[model samples]
Target: MSTLSTLKDRIGRYGVWSVGLRAEDPARRGQLAEAATELEQLGYGAVWLGGSSAARHAVPLLEATRTLTVGTSIQSIWDYDAETSAASFAEVDAAHPGRFLLGLGVSHAKLADQYRRPYSALVAYLDALDAAGVPADRRVLAALGPRTLELARDRAAGAVPYLVTAEHTAQARAILGPDPLLAPELKVILETDPSRARTLAREFLAMYLALPNYTNNFLRLGFTEDDLTNGGSDHLVDAVFAWGDETHIRDRINTFHEAGADHVALQVVTGGDRDTLPREEWRRLASLLG
Candidate 1:
């Protein structure tokens, strides 16, 4: 079977995880392992590690769990070469077959400026990935626009779009056709209070708002200039981040599923300064969603 087909078969249901792994805290390494184990035990299909994490960083997390797919929702294409990444994928697949998904992205002009050649560089990168023998089905692209989405459909399994809504999922599904994988990340703030939830959501969204790629995607989704300004408008906030009690969150996830998302990776947003305490939020969401 093709690698994408294998992924679809393995991740039979849906999955959830934080946006990124919090490896900055040395004390929490054991807790992170335990959390991975618990997430797998709870029946969540895959755990998505985010962009900031290194390819090597996910090894321990994958080793700590069994039968749960560990994926990089994205690793920057600029930071790592396809030959090295493909070798790593081969190593991980040999060690834990059908348990690793590599999500790749072109990143934004601002971020890609460090390496130069923002657009053409990505196409070259994809060619290199092919030349290096990274099978199309084993990887996914972090795409939003039509061109990148088309490239993803032709070159990789599908697309892994972050900071998107069910509406965007439906659009992406239309672009990707019937066979390729379409997994989009949803941010959920599990708080009932509107003011507090929006505050927390905006705080998490601040950095992304500054980034051009996210802003351009939001614009493509019909968000006006004013809506993208000042962190984000109410409509933009509500659409992007699902905030409320358990039932509300459940419905939100189902919205994405119903919109034709193959998998939905949920990022729990808690109203706290310390990232360490997200374990409570993760457990709560796992119980609610699992």
Candidate 2:
């Protein structure tokens, strides 16, 4: 079967997106592996490591699960050059073929001192990855805009847009046409109360709001400056995040699929410390989906 077809089969309708899954510390390897195993057992087709994760961070999870596809939600172009990324992809794919998806992105200027000519740099990076033999089908991009989405369609497997609305998903699918993967990362808060949910969503979204890339995209999506103020307005929060009861959240997730997302990478926000795994929330999500 073709690699794209294999990806469609391997990554099911929904997957877990978590920064806690990144195995940066040696001591967390076992815990990370165990969590990955449970996620696989819970019937999640993939686990996307959040933050600027690379193929190396996916090693423990890939090792622990036989079929769960582990991917970097984004390994910034600034963080690792294409040659190093290609080597990591080669090393990981050799150990576990057809199981790793290299998700690349040009992160925000605030985070990367080297951020410049991002679009052009991304093209060059893809060119290098091509020369290094990283199959286009095995990689994805953290694309949010039209130009990058076009690059994702033409150069890579597909687009995995972060912090997008269903409206953006529809627009992206229109750009990508029918073939490549379109997996957008969605934040989920299991809370039912609007007051509590929006508060948590605002707290989580505050950092992203400061970044212009996201703000620009929000504007492009039809949100106003008012919507972007004070973390995020209710309308903006409600649009981007899936919250409330199980049924409500499920319906919200379905909107993305209806809008043309092949997979939704769900990141659960618990209004707690970032380090904890939030396994119970994951379990609830699995059951909710089921």
Candidate 3:
């Protein structure tokens, strides 16, 4: 089978583990490599690196883990040219064929404004990737709206919608049909205490609320303007973030699977000042999920 086809099959069979890469973390690089290795040891199918600058942050993690598939939950297409990105992809692919999935995005207009003409620039970028021989199936788009979803279907593997609810996953699945991959990132606080979990959830939601792309996505899913304001309403928080104990988090993951998500990438929210979060949480969760 083709690499993309094999990846789609693997995603269908085994769900994804997506982690964020925060620049603030001191042990970030080591933690990422360790996490990737541990997740692979735990038998998790894939590791998605988020908040990366194109493939720069992802390369080390990919180099560290042997068997696990690694991908950018998104690399801003505006940040790196297709030839450079494709060259990076080729270098990684040469070492680990079919193990790296390229998730590219137009990013938000606010962020894309630094480059000018966001949409047109993204189109030109995609054309460049095509010209550089990055196979359509080897890459996926970070899309949410209908138009971008259509573009993803035509030009890439599929869509990687971030911070989305299961309802939106179902809707996106319907729009993309059955063939293309639909792997949405789901945020989980993993705390048993409601108040504490909500606090962490809101803390994480704060920055995302300011991003228009995410706000508009929530709006399309029926959230009112009030729901988007002030660190998000309780209902909005509950809908976007899955909290509580392990059972609750697992149930939320299963909901997305049942809702027709080919793969659900789990972003585990951590507390305390430590960068790696004790590794025990990841170990326990991996055992529970595995």
Query: Root-mean-square deviation of each candidate, in angstroms?
Result: 2.0, 0.8, 2.6
Off by more than 4 A, model 2 = none
In the range 218-283, model 1's lDDT, one tens digit per residue, is 988888999987778889999989889899988988899899899888788775553443666777
lDDT of each: 0.80, 0.95, 0.77
- Give lDDT: candidate 1, residue 2: 62
Question: For every model shown, what is its TM-score relative to the native structure?
Answer: 0.92, 0.99, 0.90
Best by lDDT: 2
Question: What lDDT score is found at residue 79 in candidate 3?
Answer: 77
lDDT (Cα) of model 2: 0.95
Candidate 3 runs further than 4 Å off: 1-4, 11-31, 272-278
Which lDDT tens digits does candidate 2 get at residues 66-151? Answer: 99998998999999989999999999999999899999999999999988999999999999999999999899999999999999
lDDT of 2 at 181: 93
Candidate 1 yields a Cα-based lDDT of 0.80
Q: On a 0 to 1 TM-score scale, where does candidate 2 land against the true structure?
A: 0.99
Residue 152's lDDT within candidate 3 is 81
Worst 10 residues of 3 by lDDT: 15-24
Sorted on TM-score, highest at the top, how do the candidates line up? 2, 1, 3
Report the Cα lDDT for residue 262, model 1. 90
